[model samples]
Target: MPDLWQNICLHILLTCPIFVNVWSRHDHLYMGLDHRHHHHLHYEKDNDLSLWINEMQVKMFSGFSMKIFAIDNGKVSPHIKDPNFSMYLPTIPSEVSYVNFTWKSGAKKYDYHFDRLQSLDENILKPPSISIKTKGRVPRNPKEFSVFLPCSGNVSGVAMFSIGLLIQTRKGKPLPGTPLRLTLRKECAHRGVYDRASLTASQGPDPECDKKCANNGWCNHEKICQCPEGYMGQYCTQALCYPQCQNGGNCTAPAICSCPKGYQGRHCEG
Candidate 1:
């Protein structure tokens, strides 16, 4: 009876189909297991999702040894061959932008690459600084912005890059180690400056519009200056009738000629 039971157990173990459901705890969404090489590989699921690893790849036989290993793969896609690349940052006169990055180099030198200029916000869109030409030839200023790390392949050094436009006119120098994150967003359908007008004709939080008028003038919905009683001109910077009454003439309306006893007509012209 013991021998018959042993044979029955052996037959069931060998003949019955085994179904294993494996859930991965790794950060990667898709992975592949090579049966012949006994290794695991990380696969990008964007372009080649159809060739992704199926449920059969993660299974393990009862007698097979399972090895756990992780590989750091930074390559985003197969088509882009460059692991390290150079980026030519845009130039603007007296304007400076910054980028925060990590650097790890065993080779003599490596470059930071950029595909194109993109922005996440359209209202804040400004032209790149690198494209602008300065009044004089700019001197070659090499900035020491990188933090050095001890010799370790696993460790990386953080660094900052400062893109200079106009150094003198800048509000202040940028703080080290801080970087501006760049992104690309869809273009806005409506052109020109964006402005939100309320029922009382007050300005809303539309970032594109700005109040550049001087004195008590208000910036209208079209971005034009709405001069107050005493102010005038495009930016409301000029006084309508200040000291304009030459030769002892009494000042009245803006740009209106108010002549003295001997003078007459506009500006008190004789």
Candidate 2:
């Protein structure tokens, strides 16, 4: 009887490895749906996407060890060394609709540059061709690297940028880490256009007033509602200052009647 029990236990142990492997793959496939506990560095949630630089030995290519740093938000993270180095950018703020890569350095020697960077927007008909403008001055540090992205603009989407170096030897041989592919989280959004549903949406206006303003008007902290072109009123509900502009008066401003000849008072209602 003891031998029979031992044999059964051995059979269960042999099959457990296969079951665990299958379950792990299944869990990964559904990670997006249940990401509250997901801790993998490579697969973060969409709203909390992070950028990273994988490990690679720069000295292997140029025979000189090189350092790398990520500069963003007026702050620089810790520097990375050759081989087995990874730099993870901060979790993307919800207000940031998308990233922008406006410029790059034009230095010929020992300057930081991206070898592999591209937009993740699948809708983009053709990604913008990165123009290496020789007109710019040499970038002294990572701050003045000419990449002033992360702005609000008409275009919106995830701007993927792969970092690389330009090691120009006397022989002009090709360098390593030429283009590192970045698997960016795709998003269709323009720069500087914070999501309306986010807390940052009220950054420029009074929280309550912004939601109260109607008919293309924006509310300010002082409760002054700024109406759009061709509209006026405290809440932008009235078409004109006097709606009908009695006595031929015109609406020069919201709720402020502009009386015509011989007409006066708030609504030009002599």
Model 2 residue 22 CA deviation (Å) reads: 42
lDDT of residue 214 for candidate 1 = 72
Clashing pairs in 2: 116-162, 117-162, 151-192, 152-191, 152-192, 153-191, 155-190, 156-189, 156-190
| TM-scores of all candidate predictions against the true structure | 0.17, 0.25
lDDT of 1 by residue, 214-252 (tens): 777565544544544344344545444322445666545
Error of 1 at 263 (Å): 74
lDDT of 2 by residue, 199-220 (tens): 1122233547677678777764
Kindly report which residue stretches of model 2 are placed more than 4 angstroms away from their true locations once superposed. Answer: 1-91, 94-115, 124-143, 148-166, 173-183, 186-270
Cα distance off (Å), candidate 1, residue 265: 74
